[model samples]
Target: MIGNVPSDFRLPTSDSVIGRLADDVVLSIEDLWVEYQTPAGPMQAVRGATLEIRRGEAVALIGESGSGKTTLGLALLRLLTRTARVSRGRARFRIGDGRTLELFSLGGSDLRRFRWQECAMVFQAALNSLNPVLKVRDHFIETARAHGRKDDRQTSERARELLRMVQLDGERVLSSYPHELSGGMRQRVSIALSLLLEPQLIILDEPTTALDILTQRAIIDVIRSLRQRLNFTMMFISHDLSLAAELADRVATMYAGELVEVGKVRDVFYTPKHPYTVGLLNAVPPIAGEEFTPLTAIPGSPPDLLAMPSGCSFHPRCPYATELCVRQAPPLFAVGNGHQAACFHWERVTRRLDVWEGAVR
Candidate 1:
């Protein structure tokens, strides 16, 4: 949608400004429970997971492929597939204009209208999300026109401007279809469309997963710029911890349908408390320093959700698991400085080890 506006255009505003304007919480997920009705029975995807995203804050949901990050993200928008249902939970979204809506209770038209207009999603695959039949400008026009905020003239101008914001030439990209553009370019277009509604929050599910390294960097740059300029909150869902750490103000780690840890990005990165968090950090390639050691992958795979363990789901794979970890589940307890981890021996695990200190190698 945003093509050829300008490469030199000023980026968006920081979270600080958005925080000031809308003081109330923008998104709150309280004790969510999502389940899928498989032949084996109801398999839980999210079990009593709670999270919050303030206005303009960039939060990331990080975990493995089936760790429920995408499920949680979809639940936030009530976009789950037919088989998957929200068994128990409350997701409250307070819009920019002081309107509150409970996503679970909202029905047909309301849900559809609110989806992109108030909260939009940029899914993992670009081709799947975008219509190959339509031109870039037409897509933007359709979205903009749906809201009735901008007509043809205004839509055209906004489309061009939006393309420019994503570092694409407006004219060329506007005329192009899904196949004509590169993967990264298509992603940018998706981002631009997501912004058309000027939604208060945008959920990006593995936005850069399909792109090459260079294009991925460009897309990340665009996200950063947009976040700065737009001052909107974001829910960045990804399996890549390194990328999440680079963009998010805070990161929430999920393991086997449960939230394992959540805290400030630096806290989660530098001083991860949960064993799963530690494993994830150790598994990701370091970006800041050249002297860092190679990543260590988590030994075992996640357990089957249909018949999970009695206590901690991560007990099977966690090296630090003890009798307590195997007997009873741990709650997300506050560790320090807005850091929390669902591990009984977080203190012991975090204190006795310093993997990044060149000692673990």
Candidate 2:
């Protein structure tokens, strides 16, 4: 069992609430834009990002470091710092009983209740997220109390169950401080804490960051197991394409704050239509290829968010760029079954499928 809830545990489920309708979608973001106020000017961190995460589906948002993957994740939970502002967007989240809540508009006690009870976010830095002074058990107690889980005995039992699920010894881990545990242990604790409230959706930002290869593999296994047992909706934000391929049901490629491609894991990896997505694939060495496959890095760096390039932000580095690409930004065009790419020369990408196929093999 995921969690042994108290007899009175319940989430708000009013049928009167209404928003944009989406069947089977747990979270739907439409035309979302986020900006950060800087010394130079406003930095466009996330731009016109629209995607739907269905119930119990794992969606990976993959991109380069500055491609706004983390920014978008933070925006969804309203966890952005004071410097950042969500300029415009509609993030409609499905609550129980066929009701949809506009996430961006929530405030005060409603927002507080929505955060841990409905959705949770595991931050990138696990060590920093945990308090140095607080013991592991205290962390669990505090989080549970904050979300109205008042029964200390029940809360501790739930925390222990979650910790065991993540492959940690509950009794031992509960007594230790954050500094006492290894990097992997801390990460596992964070994962366990995120599940303490039995959230319907969880957003993990680089959950395997700053860990050894062995530890990363362990973390991956733990995540896979948790998903199988609990079946919560997840949005995994990462620059690591290999890990994303292994964990995600769907892949959404982001470039300069815009979603360049969104499709099934197999479709996006094997037959990418966007040049940026293809470039990303070319850069990573395949896990199973026997022969030596030369890695081809995408030329140039990610554009400056303050003064973004004209038309398609990726046009400067695209191998198949045309005059039209420089003059007009391309909207996401349907390429295949549930596959979309924002590229005028997507057909060129299709012609070169053999190259990508060989790279992955």
Candidate 3:
């Protein structure tokens, strides 16, 4: 099932873009753990999530609902809810300079100073994030001021530039209120606001979730254009595998708070090594052949995080799982060039896939 870039696939590119694709690790996140502190007990929301994000590229976090994709993204930027906490792991982040900083280690002014200026977030429900009472210009002014933009004239100009960057008419959009704009336009404005400070990394937590299919496609195109022009890296968090397939150079599939598989989009989509990833790819409707085939389901719901099953979290739902899969936690095993999966029987799993495909015919 492995193939090179398909004829229809495309991604943003620019001569002005900084850093080679897949060459530099802009953010080094290691064994990150997150939990929600409750009276009952601390409930783990994310477990040992680890990966490195390359500069000027999109790395997508994709999985079913409650897979902790959102939590992991929130934890990376220290934007979790008050009740939640990042108890373990570290994210080493590098900005314009070569120097790196442990994001969680910094406190008070240090963290405040680094955040937004270097990294920004485009929230899930970004359309409703705007204040109904304020004008669009006011929103930009507030963001600029919070980041210490003292001169109103300069901030206004920058705001106009950002509006233009997102293909919006600066004068009209700046004068209008949030209620006046369409859902898609408001979402674009949110993205423009994220780039107001020219952050090196942008966390897009389901930016296109609420939009219609056509609107979603337009927004994705806008993001690609912006990324090409601005050269800012992105972490796209979504459940839409098709959307992830378009934007991401690399794909990380999460399951039950852990990353089950991570590699190039072509690798994970066409030649998945993890059982969970396999199930997900199978479920997605194909655009070409097999258009009339029955939609395949993974056959079971995800495990409850509060009372998670022992050993491999995905073993319960995996068709190829064995005694070893239920007895010991499997480490990430190398499957292909720069591809890895947490499965003890990945070799046997691939063979079963072939046989299963034959039976389907």
**TM-scores of all predicted structures:** 0.89, 0.92, 0.89
Q: What is the per-residue lDDT of model 1 for residues 123-237, given as tens digits with 9 covering 90 to 100?
A: 8998888998999888988887766656788888888888899999999999999999988999999999898878889999999996899999999999999999988889999
RMSD of each: 7.9, 4.7, 9.0
Give one digit per residue, the lDDT tens place, for model 3 in 142-223: 8888767878788889989988888899989999999999988899999999899899999999989979888898899999
On a 0 to 1 TM-score scale, where does candidate 1 land against the true structure? 0.89
CA shift of 329, model 1, Å = 0.6
Top model by TM-score, which number? 2
Q: What is the per-residue lDDT of model 2 for residues 1-361, given as tens digits with 9 covering 90 to 100?
A: 1133334434333431455456699998999999999999898899999999999999999999989999999998889999999998778887644567788877766678678778899988999999999999999999999977789999899989999999999999999999999999999999999999888899999999789999999999999999999999999999999988999999999999999999999999999999999989888886685898777767778898988889999988877787999999999999999999999989878535344332321
Candidate 3: residue 142 Cα off by (Å): 1.2
Lowest summed lDDT over 10 consecutive residues: which window, candidate 1? 12-21
lDDT of 3 at 154: 89
Give the residue spans of candidate 3 off by over 4 A: 1-23, 289-291, 351-361
Alpha carbon lDDT at 119, candidate 1? 93
